[model samples]
Structures are given as C-alpha cells and as structure tokens.
Target: MFWEPLRARFTREALTRSFVALRIRDYRRWSIAQLLSGAGAAASQIAIAWLVIELGGDGIALGAVTACMMLPTLLLGPFIGILVDRHTRRAVLLVTAVAQMLIAGVLAALTFGGALELWMLMALSLAHGVAFAADNPARQLLVMDIVGRERMTSAVSMNEVIINGARVIGPAIAGVLLVVSDAGWCFVVNVLMFVPSIFVLLSLRPVAPAGRTEPADSTAAAARPIGAWRFAMHTPAIRATLLLAVCASACYNIAVVVPLIVADVFHADGGTYGALAVAFGLGALPGAFFSATGPTMPRSAEVRAMAVAMAAAVLLSAGAPTLPLLFVGLAAVGMVVMWFIARANAFVMLSTPTAIRGRVMGIWAMALPGSTVVTGLLIGGLADLTDPRIAYGAVGLVTALVVTLSWRGLRSAR
Candidate 1:
C-alpha cells in the first residue's frame, strides 16, 4: 500500500468492505497495541500544548516545542530508514519503545516536581522526536511482516482507524487529566502505554515481505543504502504523491491553530480543546473505514483531487464563527484529510517492494511530521501575528494553489 493511495468515489458497501483487514490473526493482535500507543501519543500532545500555555509561553513557544518534536525526522529520517531496513524491525521498535518510556518518565518527574521549564520541555520533546523517527518506519514496515501485500490496502485503512480512534479517546482522557490531575499524569500514561506493545513484539516471530521467497536476511542484503530515495524520486506515481504530501503536511497541521482558535476565537477551556480534537477523530473514522475497499495503490490523479477537496475543508473550518459550527468544520477537515493521507500512504507502500519499504517509507515520513518541522513554526507564528482563522485560511489557499497549478507531471498510473 506504499505507492498508490484512492478514488474520491465512495458508497454504502464500503462500510462493510472496510472490515476486510480484520481477517488476519496477526494483524488483529498488532492493531491492539497500535491503538493503545496512538491514544497515549494523542493524549500527550494535547497535554503538552496545554502545559505550554500554562507555563507563561506563547504561540511561538507552542510552535518551537512542536517543531522540536518533528525536527529530528526531517534531519535524520532517511538515514534511520536505511538503518531499520538493515536490521530486525522488532529490535528497532523495542529500543524505541523503551527510549520513549524513559523520556516520558523524566518529563513526568520534572512536571511533578514543579521544576518543569519551557526549555526542558522542548529538550525532552526533541529527544522524543528522535525516538519517533526510528519508531515510525520500523513499525510501519512491520505491517508487511505481519500481513502480506494483498491485504495492505485494508490494513493501511485499518491503521488509520486505529490512529483516529485513538485521537478520539486520547484527547478526552487528557481533558479529564488536565482538569482533575496534571499534565504529569498524561506523561505517566505514556510511560505505561508501551508496555503491552513491547510484550507483543517480544512474543511475535518475523515473516518475509511479499514477493520474497527467501529468508528475511536475504531481503535485507538487497536493500541498498540509497535505493529507497532513488526509487521514490524516479517513480512518477510515488513522486507526485509525495510532492503533494509536502503541501498536505503544511495544510493539515491544525494542532497549532486548534488551541488558539478554541481560546481566542471560541473562548473555551481544556475541555473544549479535547472536544474539538475528538470531533476531528470521530469525523475521520467513517472515511477511514470507508477507504478500506479501494485498490492497494491509488492513481496519482485521484490523490491530487483529494488535496483540493481537503483545502476546501480547511477554509470552511477557518471561517466557522461559532463553536458548534467549528466542530462541524473540523470534523469535515478530519474526514477529508484522512482519505488524502490514506491515499498517499497506500501509494508508497503498495507500489514498492517489501525489501526496501523501510527506507522508502522513511522518506514518506520526512514529508509529514518531518515537514511539520517548518510548518509547525510557521503555523504557530502565523497564529501569533494574526489569528487561527488567518493561519488556517492562508495555508488552505496555498494548498489549493499548489495542487491546482501542477497537474501534468504524473503519467496516469499504469
């Protein structure tokens, strides 16, 4: 599901077809762990953003902290991608899980002791992002390890379901913790979330990627150092999808604006922040479920089309003057953006080989959380200068223009 991502066309039957990925036993077990970890991550993100606001920090501080969490992937993702391809994905994942737990512990400790500062938070976040870069590709390519290629389309959609579902639960939990306890408790939850996944990974055995009859080691031997980069750059469908992702990354970065909008525009509190985030996750769930029926790899044209639709969703979200309307708008954004991302990710995963997927998907990773390194600050700064509505409107227009102007390069996927 790495190469081509989807058609905007959808129907009622898609709801039933989306369950196709659940038939595999290993994938079900793997998804359970993914759901928990994703929830904890989502919860922690809101917790951190609220903590920044509480700590005498401004929008720039929010942007810097967010940027720090993503900066490592922009800087080291490609190299780390190659590294995971050369080794056992399980080991890389295990190490990353442990590293994140330790970092979360320290963060929790600092906050609980009343000694947590903005700089300390940023430092820990940068460390977390470093672990995140290593964690992402290894974990993703491991889907190939658990489920074969034929199911990759539904599996990717199911993965979105897990992520967005976590988004729904995580923020709700964070909202409660922020009201009753402290942000430190959110970090404590993060420390605990990885425990089941570590056990699951330790219990699992490895499988070879699709199209590979050889043992896993032989596959690793053929995954050359620069192969993923060269393959993605040269491949037209993959190239177009990823390029669109650069703009998609910037446009979809609404985290910075959500808090600002809730506070400044809506005059809301922590509960409202979590409610809006939940709305986003909830809205995406149906689309994520519906997307499970498509071809494993999407045509490049459809990917471009989805980008335009997502831009419209963002602009509408920006213009929502009332909170209820904002919920409707953000939910719409989440629904459309989920499809956009699902298409982009499936393109990269399905079009490429199992052997080199780790490295290639690393480059894909560079486009999102990696792109956030710049977009995070830009969004934060834009909101600081104007307002959330301006920040959202500007990025929305830019995404529409970028996707609309460059329509010719990708040859129709053969």
Candidate 2:
C-alpha cells in the first residue's frame, strides 16, 4: 500500500537518526533529552506570559518581558557562539539545563509566596536568557557531534517537530492547570518535566566535539567575542540562511496583529488567543514532519515553496475579516514559518563544519530575534498611526518584495 511505504520511510528516518549522524546511541540519547528539555522550556514560557497578565501587565509590559526573554539572544548570542566552540558541548548543555531548572524553582517560590514583582520577573528572565544563549548553540552543535552529517536535515526537522509537539501539548496542559491553581504550579510542573531531560543528557556517553578545543589558559578565546559572526560571514550558505531568517522574522508581525484583530475588531478574549496558537501549531507540525523525511527535491525547491507559502499567508492574514478566517490565515502562515526555519537551520548545519556549527547557528539565532525586535517596535508605532490590520497589510507587501528580491540569493546559497 502507498500508506505502507510512507509509514516505512518515516520510521526509517525517525529510527535511523543516529545512523545519519553515524552515532545512533549518543544521538538518540541526546534527542530524547532535548525533547524533554524543549517541552519544559515551552511550558515555562507560557507560564511567564500568563503570570504577567495575572499581575496586571499591559501590552507594553508584555512586550518588555518578551524582550527580556529575547534580548540576550540578540546581544550575547555571538559571544556564546565562541563559548560553544571553546567548551565541551555536552557539558554546556547540562549546565544550562540545571541553571534553567533552578531559575524555574525560584520563580515558583516567588509566585507561591506572593512576592513576585516585575523586577524579579525581569531578573529571572535575564537569567533564562543567558542560559538560552549558551544552550542554543550547544544543542545545535550537538546534532553534529552525535549524528555527524549523513542525515542532518532529518535530525534538524525532527528536532523541530519534537519541540513544536511539546509546544502543542504544553500550553493546553498549562491552560488547564492555570485555571485549576496558581501559575506557580505551572512552574513546578516545568521543573518536574525537566528532570527527564537532565537524566537523559547525563545518560548519554560523552562525545567531545570533533575539532580542536580552545586552550584552557588562552587570551585568544577572550579576544574573539564576535568570532561567530566572522565565521558565518565567511561561509556563504550560513550567511544566506541568516539573511533569510531576518527577512522572515521581520515579516512575522502578522502574529502580533492576530490579537489586535481578534480583540479590537472581533471583541474576543484570551481563549481566542489560545485557539490561534493551537491552530498555528497544528499547521506547522506537518511541515516539520514532511521535511524530516528524505527528499528528492533540491533544497532550493523547498525554500521557494516556503517563500511562496509565506507570501500567501501574510496576504491572507492582512485581509481576513473574521476570527475563523484569521485563524486559517495564521495557521497557513505558521506552516510556512516552520518550513523556512527548519530548512534554513538544515542549511546551516550542512554548510558548517562540526568545529564551528555552534557559532554559525548562534549567528542564525541573532538574525531572527534582532529582526523581530526591530519589527515589533515598528509595528507598534504603525498600529498607533492606523489600525493594526492595515499595518499588517503593509508588512505583508514588504515581505512579498523580500521574496522577490531575496529568492535568488537564497537559491545561490543552496
């Protein structure tokens, strides 16, 4: 049956992840650990947003908190990349998971004691940011170490699917828990969920990075703060993917406009927001699944498909008249967004050597967060001038132009 072959192929891709990287035992262990860790991270993020709202946060406060969570990636990600190259990737990941678990515990305590303040929230956010800046590069680099390079695209896509799968499950559970008790319980659950990750990571047999390690007593490591940037700029495919990330992120203000359209126009509430999130998550899941399977299509073909989908999704969202219609548009947008991200990350992993994979991915990390920050500020100002709907429409137009102008560069990179 057609279904049998499809199922067989997917099973092969999923089960053979370690084979692709050429180290099944280590990669399997690492992948499981990452899945656990990613779920906890997603849950914790949802908890933070809800906690802020419960404490009377306005849009600006929400923005500030979100920015705090993101700013480290923008500011310190490059330096973290250097660290990823210098240190043991597995050790870096373990330390980060432990640090994040501790942060969650503190947040839980503060919430339980009714002593949580905006400053405390900001401080915890900063701590999480630092941990994330290091953890991201470490994890990306680990894909290379455990798997090598044979099935990198599969590994990258599967990793995303695992993360997004958690995204889908985490929020629904958090929502139920948030209504049943305080947000602190959400944090507690996150701490508990992270245990499996820490355990799995520890269980993996240690595999050092494939290249030369930096010397323990070197001023050289101290001097090369922006070394990741230098490395990525020198590598054509990595640079191209980073640029694509920037453009895609800038165009993603359609997400920002979703709540505005629902609340101001359709007169909806928080539940509607959750539905939109779920819709988007469900739409994106399939894209990740498809990419995880082997493909006869050129990488360029995949990227162009993503670009077209993004353009259409944006245009549809801008013109959506009702909540239901808007969700369909947002979901379509989400599907393409994942496609673009997973493909770009795959490209980065393929192009970079194991030695510098972390640094290169760190540069990729900087592009999306930095562009989102800029785009958020611009969209906020535009919302003041006109309705968010119109502002979103204009963004869609700009992104379409991005597809037109940037497609060739991306194609060349592949």
Q: By TM-score, who's the top model here? A: 1
Q: Which stretches of candidate 2 lie over 4 Å from their true place?
A: 1-26, 54-56, 211-240, 250-263, 294-298, 349-358, 384-394, 411-414
Clashing pairs in 2: 21-147
What ranges in model 1 sit over 4 Å off? 1-18, 206-237, 349-358, 410-414
- Residue 9 miss distance in model 1 (angstroms): 8.0
For candidate 1, give the lDDT of residue 58.
70
Please give the lDDT score at residue 70 for candidate 2: 68
Clashes of each: 15, 1
**Tens-place lDDT digits, model 2, residues 1-414:** 636634654675455642354247766766666666666666676677656656765444545665666678888765666567667787998899889889999999999999999878878987888888788778877776766655665567668787777766666666566656777877887888878777876776677665554477367655554575687776654565676677677554333455556556787654565566667767778767666664523376567667667777877877888778888887787778777777666667666676556556656777876556566556655754687778677777776776677666666764
lDDT of each: 0.79, 0.68
